[model samples]
Target: MTDSMSDTLNNEIIVPTMAQMAAEGKQPDILFWVGCAGSFDERAQKITRDICKILQHVGISFAVLGTEESCTGDPAKRAGNEFLFQMQAMANIQVLDGYNIKKIVTGCPHCFNTIANEYPGLGGNYEVVHHSQLIQQLINEGNLKAEGGESFKGRRITFHDPCYLGRGNNVYEAPRAALEVLDADLVEMKRCKSNGLCCGAGGAQMFKEPEPGKKDINMERMNDVLEANAQVVASGCPFCMTMLSDGVKHTEKEQEIQVLDIAEITVRANGL
Candidate 1:
């Protein structure tokens, strides 16, 4: 059967999610999949590249399939455009099948959740992990080390948990773990984890303009960070990074505060 036809057929079959698929078998080795959010943002792309570099230094053999990358259809799916999401999902599955991708690592939380949790329904399944988790593993194995620099000692930082990564996928620890690895003094926001506020950029809000609300989602998150007197705000998802960065800028707090991805901070901690 033609590849497209095969994908269409696969989509019709219900399959276990990627996490379930991972649990069902020995892990596969070879591919690192970057979803649209990571691929589209310069900083996020850098983080993914840096992660691969770190893994390469530790003798992990893998390849990045950026050109083969596509949106996880998360936005469409979350926005209630199931048909478009399915089409996108099928297309991505076709690419993965072509590469025979057995394992995937992603930086974006939304992409991670969608590819790991939702793709099974469309018959695409693979072992997927957030970059933070992988980095933590590397650190534990003595494969990755942080060459401490001027400590962020006095600079208080707060973490804004991305909805998809934290609540949607229950990946609250990895990012926090990564920050802790940096020896960062982290102050938790009153609203964190499942109760964390949205950055207003999820569910494809990044692609479309945000609707009017009592306050901008990003602004709400920024206020929480500012209230903590944090000099830096760290997040796992690129959309969150971008939105929160914009939030700081919009609030005229750019000079007083900064937004960074966990990976970026990790690289810095290691004096990369």
Candidate 2:
């Protein structure tokens, strides 16, 4: 982690995506980091808590760095606010160091990307895993099992990939794996994975009004779900869930469809 790396962490310089952030490493055992999106959104917060609850049920003891949690500077970096991104990154690094936390799990794809991929430039490096990945591991280890009785019984559904998680981070399968564990009828959108469309809420779009475009990014994605005839649209990222839910509202598709996070869907499946 050099200053140049730190400087370029959010400098919009070409670099590896979030999927390549962890090559091999040792990590701390306690802290699970939740980014601003997870903290700020009630639905995301519920998902985070649900993850923690599931992990705890499996005998994993972890602490949430709530007050110490700050923006990962991802939005700022994406919006060309380099100074703010740098400052926020530094503050996050300092907070992590204060807790001697060397590992983190995040529910937000943007946070996971910044902390895992970009933080090394600022000399802040840690083993970061997305919550879905961790949950998958737990299920594989038999620590957590999906309650297959009546919770997961539902109509057909499709998943919308968040840019940071699906394209930016290359994490297409983990959330799907979690869904599969719950016996979800996973239907793929025509445009999925790295090719998935934006949710109209990334790159700081959540903070400001959306720019004019032929079609709303989120609406375009919702139309894909509608085309699939999916009754439920599932997503992992909060931003994606929010934007897509909005899209459903904007398109007046809520009557015909429902939006849910992977965690929420899983929790329902588990009868929790």
Q: Estimate each model's TM-score.
A: 0.84, 0.85
**What is the lDDT, from 0 to 100, of the residue 211 in candidate 2?**
73
* lDDT string, candidate 1, 14-88, tens digits: 222334334565333656666676676786777666565555445565566545567888899989999999999
Model 2 lDDT, residue 127, Cα: 89
In model 1, pairs of residues that clash are none
Tens digits of lDDT, candidate 2, 1-272: 24323433333222221222223332325567767767778867777766655544454545667565788999999999999999999998987876667778888889989999999999898989888788778778876677743455556778888888888888888888877776656788889888888888988999897777787778778778888888888888888878988888988977888888877776666644
lDDT of 2 at 150: 44
Displacement of the residue 188 alpha carbon in candidate 1, Å: 0.5
| Model 2 spans > 4 angstroms off | 1-28, 148-150
* Predictions: Cα RMSD each: 10.1, 10.8
Clashes of each: 0, 3
Model 2 residue 60 lDDT score: 54
Quality of model 1 by C-alpha lDDT = 0.74
Give the best candidate by lDDT.
Answer: 2
